[model samples]
Target: MSGANIERREIFRAIGELAYVVAKSDRGLTPAERQVFFQIAQEELDYDSWAAQSRFELLDEVIQPSIDRAYNDALHELRKYSAYLTEDIKEKVMTVLQRVAVCCEGLSANETFVLDRVRKDLQSLG
Candidate 1:
């Protein structure tokens, strides 16, 4: 694939994984959380939500990674594509994560912690 396409895929993949991580942080991925995740992804990322949704499905169905593993994997992708992580992109990323965290119910402490770490990691990219 072309470099641009590869980067896009990687970034969206990370977004999907992050959505999984946040949703699964407390009480597992609830039906409401899943719905909100896709909705926010489509609303926030537009066409790119396809890649994110694919990754989210993969984690939810196939891999079922641990929370730490999911977070680390997404972090790795973000760092790998660090050049593409402009401020606007980071804002969108956090928006999706934050929205998902509060979607099904109030945000859990685990979600709060995960979001904080994600925010810090993304901020550190600059």
Candidate 2:
């Protein structure tokens, strides 16, 4: 693939990691949260939906990272692709994350905390 396509896919993969982090923050990803994650991935990621799903599956079913590790890894990828994370993209990401957070049992304190940190981190990216 072209370098631009590779970078774009990596960016979406990071978005998936962020979704997994939020969904697993409270007490692991519930069925509802997983559904919301996939739906939001399809809606928000659009052309890059497959990249996001691939990363999410890797984390959820294989790697199963800790919250801190997941968040850090996602942040790393976002930073690597900061040029593409325009305000509109950032807003879409936050929207999906918040949606996933409250989809099941409502947003937990942990989810809120992670969301806040994610917001701050993304804001600081550019």
Candidate 3:
């Protein structure tokens, strides 16, 4: 892949991983949360783009490897690009993380863990 394509793919995958974590943080993904994830993946990432489509197809074709590659410690990885993403996008991501933390019947242990990590990451960006 071209350098630009690789970069975009990385961004898209990061976004996807964030969405996935948010959706699954509570250990039970809601329909609304799943829809939010799909919308973000389709709209924000422009999944129709050649590069994005290729990455999406690859993800579909090989789910486990793709997920392994996409997963990262968001608190650490996200800090590197804290200045690169728009403020709105960063806020939206944080909001999503917060929402995930509260999405379960109540806040699950995993949700609290991820939420605390996200909170620390956001605080660091400030």
Candidate 4:
């Protein structure tokens, strides 16, 4: 979670925020979705920080306070790092989001819209 990958970790943090946005968009996040969300997030954010099969209660601790505000802030944070981001990083971020969006009951309309915005945000960077 340090050294050369610091920026990548920051991007992952933003992606985690976006994931919270999507999960909360429906007003009800299933236990199954939360599990998958953490899995995908850990994989993209920094797999090295956790064990290969790590799972704990703290994994369910991401709180999405103001959906719109947090979502916009996360997107803005990613966009702010556009110049520092590599193509590979952006792809991984999107992949983490998309992978979780498909878990649970699949992407709801709100989730899809938010995800589309995230995709556009990443794509518009370069």
Candidate 5:
């Protein structure tokens, strides 16, 4: 794949993993909660193509082993590209993280873990 395609794949994969982390944070993935994750993944990451399918597939493959590890890894990947993102994109990332925190009806333990890692990762971008 081209360099840009590789980067896009990485970003989309991270978003998908984030979605999974949020959806599974409550220990169960409800349809409504899944929808929230899907919407954020699509709209925020701009993965509105067939590539989204591949990205999600990768996330499904990697996220199950350990949610916290996947989220932290994804956060590190996102931080690497922070300088290339616009202010709007950065805000969208934050929005998605917040949405994930509440995807399980409320802040569950897993969601809190993800949120804390996300907050620390984003803060380190400065």
Candidate 6:
């Protein structure tokens, strides 16, 4: 793949992993949260919801084996890609994460904690 395409894949995986973390944070992904997840993917990432969800499921498969380990790994990957994120993309990322944070029945502590860290990380990005 070309460098740009490779970067796109990496960023998608990183962000998709993040969305997974939020969705699964409380041990279940509710229908509302799922809607927000795919909404972001479709609008911001130009992906159909179902297709984006397939990729996200694939990522979760790779990461869900060890939740704690997966979280640290996702955080590292998120930070790594922050520098390459553009202003528009950063806005969308934050928006998507925020939507994920609050889209369920209500905001869970876990989701809030994750969102706080990610918000700070995105803010520091170039």
Each model's TM-score? 0.96, 0.94, 0.52, 0.76, 0.67, 0.75
CA lDDT, candidate 6, residue 72: 64
lDDT (Cα) of model 2: 0.88
Model 1, range 1-126, lDDT digits (tens) per residue? 799888978998999999899999999998778888889999999989999999998999899999899999999999999998888888988999999998877889999999999999998988
Candidate 3: regions farther than 4 A off: 1-12, 28-33, 39-61, 65-77, 101-106
lDDT of every predicted structure (CA atoms) = 0.91, 0.88, 0.52, 0.67, 0.63, 0.67
- Residue 62 in candidate 5 has what lDDT? 50
**Highest TM-score against the true fold, candidate:** 1
Q: Superposing all C-alpha atoms, what RMSD in Å does each candidate have to the true structure?
A: 1.0, 1.1, 5.3, 3.9, 3.3, 2.9
Candidate 2 RMSD to the correct structure = 1.1
Candidate 1 stretches greater than 4 Å from native: none
Model 6 lDDT tens row, 1-69:
687655556666666767777787776666667667877777766752444466567755553545455
5 or 6, greater by TM-score: 6
Pairs that clash in candidate 3 = none
- Return the clash pairs for model 5, or none: none
**Candidate achieving higher lDDT, 2 or 4:** 2
By TM-score, is 2 or 6 better?
A: 2
- Residue 47 in model 2: shift from native, Å? 1.6
Task: For residues 30-109, write the lDDT of model 3, one tens digit per residue.
Answer: 76665544544554445423333344334434552322244454434556555555566566556655654554466678
Q: Where does model 2 exceed 4 Å of error?
A: none
lDDT of 3 at 102: 58
- Please write out the lDDT profile of model 2 over residues 1-126, one tens digit for every residue: 998787878888988899999999899887777877898888877888888888988998899889899989999999998987789879878987898888888889999999999999998998
Compute the lDDT of residue 49 as modeled in candidate 6.
40
Q: Candidate 2: lDDT of 21?
A: 94
Where is model 5 poorest over a 10-residue stretch in terms of lDDT?
A: 47-56
